[model samples]
Target: MGAPVEIRGLSYAYGSGDLARPVLREVGLAVGPGEIVLLTGPSGSGKTTLLTLIGALRAMQAGSCRVLGQELAGAKEAQRVLLRRRIGFIFQQHNLLGFLTARQNVAMALELDPGTDEAGRLARAGRMLEAVGLGDRTESKPAQLSGGQRQRVAVARALAGDPGLILADEPTAALDRQSGGEVVRLLRELAKQRGVPILLVTHDPRILDIADRIVAMEDGRILPTEKAEPAPAA
Candidate 1:
């Protein structure tokens, strides 16, 4: 199956009527399986807005945005929730539960799926943490682990489901150069390993080499490359 995500002429605004402020304008993009599409732009360039729309965290305002082949032009709340479960999201903040251990935080992802038991969840979470090189810190709480370790735990949690699509927002923004590169390498390896597509919104030039394609945005539209062709996939 193709990796989830297809957008065409997508536009969005924060408010309604005259008070509305446009966030995206005629944005079109596609992410194929096993591809890493890097989205780069200045702040307020609508990169995050587009990522949220693809993650179904925000409803589509206009145009075609089919995720996992399901049209999201006017999808219902229930539909959005279902679509979200099939995608992995890595945020710049890490967003780990402050009170939970690294293992518990990762296990929380398995809770979203109905059939996984407690034992299986823990086992899987442990393995994912291990994969992220945090096997020894699984029992540490967010406060106890270093920033890199915490972010690695977040990565572990995001991948627990092996979602067909991954949406990452400046995942390495807070880390040092080495830590950031390590995380980017891990993401690139995992995405290709399972043939999952990743849409990473980042300003870090250091990680650009990890992407198969790079698309830049300004204001609210995707900027065309020097070739005068759309940088985004159709």
Candidate 2:
């Protein structure tokens, strides 16, 4: 099965009455399996908002959003929760539980599924952390890890569920250039290897070269997809 995401005429608004303001307008986009789509825009350009919508963190206020063929526009609360478990999400902030170890944080995702056994969940979490280069730090708390490592742990947690779609919001914003590049490369590799579609929201141009396609946004509207120039051969 392919990882297909479709958003049509999507719109989102904040506040109410006279204070209400729209954040997105008529936004439309589609991402296929194994596609690495980079969404770039300045702060308040609705990039994060768009990601939140795609991740089912917020309700669809207008238009339609379908992930893996399920419509999100009018989905009930329970349905949204179901969709969330199927979609992985990485935010700018690591969002790890402070008191929990990295391995525990990753295992939390699997706990939602009744079919997951305790041993299998831990094994899967450990393997995912190792894949993201955090194998040795599985027992460490978020406070003990570096910024890049924390982000990697977050990535590992996202992948623990074996989601078909991954949505990342400025995941590398807190890391150094080299670390950020490495993280992007890891995400691309995961997408390619697992046939998962990745929608990354970031303002950094440094990692743009690693994306399969770039979608620029302005004032909440998605610009056309542009082919990014290839990186220099190593």
Candidate 3:
């Protein structure tokens, strides 16, 4: 298969005419399978805008954005919706339901998969929670867990559907240093294990070690990327 994500001469703007404010300018990027790419820059550099375009959360405005081998430049809303289901998304907030247990929150994501029965969904959700080191806390509610644990549940929920690509936006911004470290490490491990390509936007320098490449953005354009040294053997 081709790279999960590819972009060329991509640009995006908001408003109309004189009110229009461009957020991405001639951006080009690609995320290969099994690769972990970190997008870093100052606020309003367009990191999140790029993620949204790649995730199909926003309609493409200019240039080509191919995701999972499908071009998005002129795709319909229905197509965008379909493309979205194939992508896993994580954000700064956990966005978990306070009423649901950890396992239930993850199982909810699987409900979108038409092939799985209720029992099968729960089983897979439990397994994913376990993979995130939350097996013992699967029965706990969001309020009953720490911020890190809630974020772990969110991660499990995102990965439960076996998505082709993962897009994360400032996933570590809300946690303590230790919690953020643990969360990003878990994400790195899971993405590597599943051979899933991840495009993560972050401002945290502490977790840069987890990336294979770091792409910087400035004033809506991408700067040259720097390859990160391979992680030391465990």
Candidate 4:
């Protein structure tokens, strides 16, 4: 298979005319399967913008961006939906339904994949939660779980689909150092064992050691080194 994500001369701007503000400028990067690339940059450096573009959550504007070999620039909604099925995302917010148990929260991810039977989805969800050290809390509601545990549930949900690529934005920012460390370890193991590419946007230096490569960004452009420590993507 080709690289899970490839971008060349990609650029993006917000608004139009007088309000147009560039968020990404000629960003070029490629992520090979089984590798974890950490993207670190100050706020508004286009890190999240790039992730959103690659995730097909937003319409692509300039240059070329290919995920799993499908060109995404100006892709239609159906095409974007088709492409997104093969990708997983873990964002800062868990976004779990309060009424759902952890297991149910994770199993719901299978809704996107109609091929998976209910039994199979639960089985896979259980295994994934176990992988992230949340096996014992499978039936707990979001309110019953700790911040770290909830995030792990989010991780399990994102990975249960056997996605080919993972895009994590500040996956560890809300957790303590130890919890953050565990999350990164789980992510690293998943990327390596499944041969899935990961592009994580994080300012957490604690997990930087887990990355195979580090790409810095600044002012909507990738930089040689991070210019300043910026807050999590807004």
Q: Evaluated with lDDT, which candidate comes out highest?
A: 3
Per-residue lDDT of model 1, residues 62-134, tens digit only? 9999888888999999999998998899999999989999999999998977898999999999999999889
Question: TM-scores of the models, in the given order?
Answer: 0.93, 0.93, 0.98, 0.93
lDDT of each: 0.89, 0.88, 0.93, 0.88
User: Candidate 1 or 3, higher lDDT?
Assistant: 3
The C-alpha local distance difference test score for the whole of candidate 3 amounts to 0.93
- For model 3, the stretches where C-alpha displacement exceeds 4 angstroms are none
Q: Give the higher-lDDT candidate: 3 or 4.
A: 3
The lowest-lDDT stretch of 10 consecutive residues in candidate 3 is 225-234
Ranked candidates (lDDT, high to low): 3, 1, 2, 4
lDDT of 4 at 63: 95
> How far off is residue 180 in model 3, in Å?
0.9
Error of 2 at 167 (Å): 0.7
Residue runs of model 1 more than 4 Å from their true location after superposition = 1-3, 225-234
Candidate 4: deviation at residue 128, Å? 1.3
* Consecutive 10-residue window with the lowest summed lDDT within model 4: 225-234
RMSD of 2: 1.9
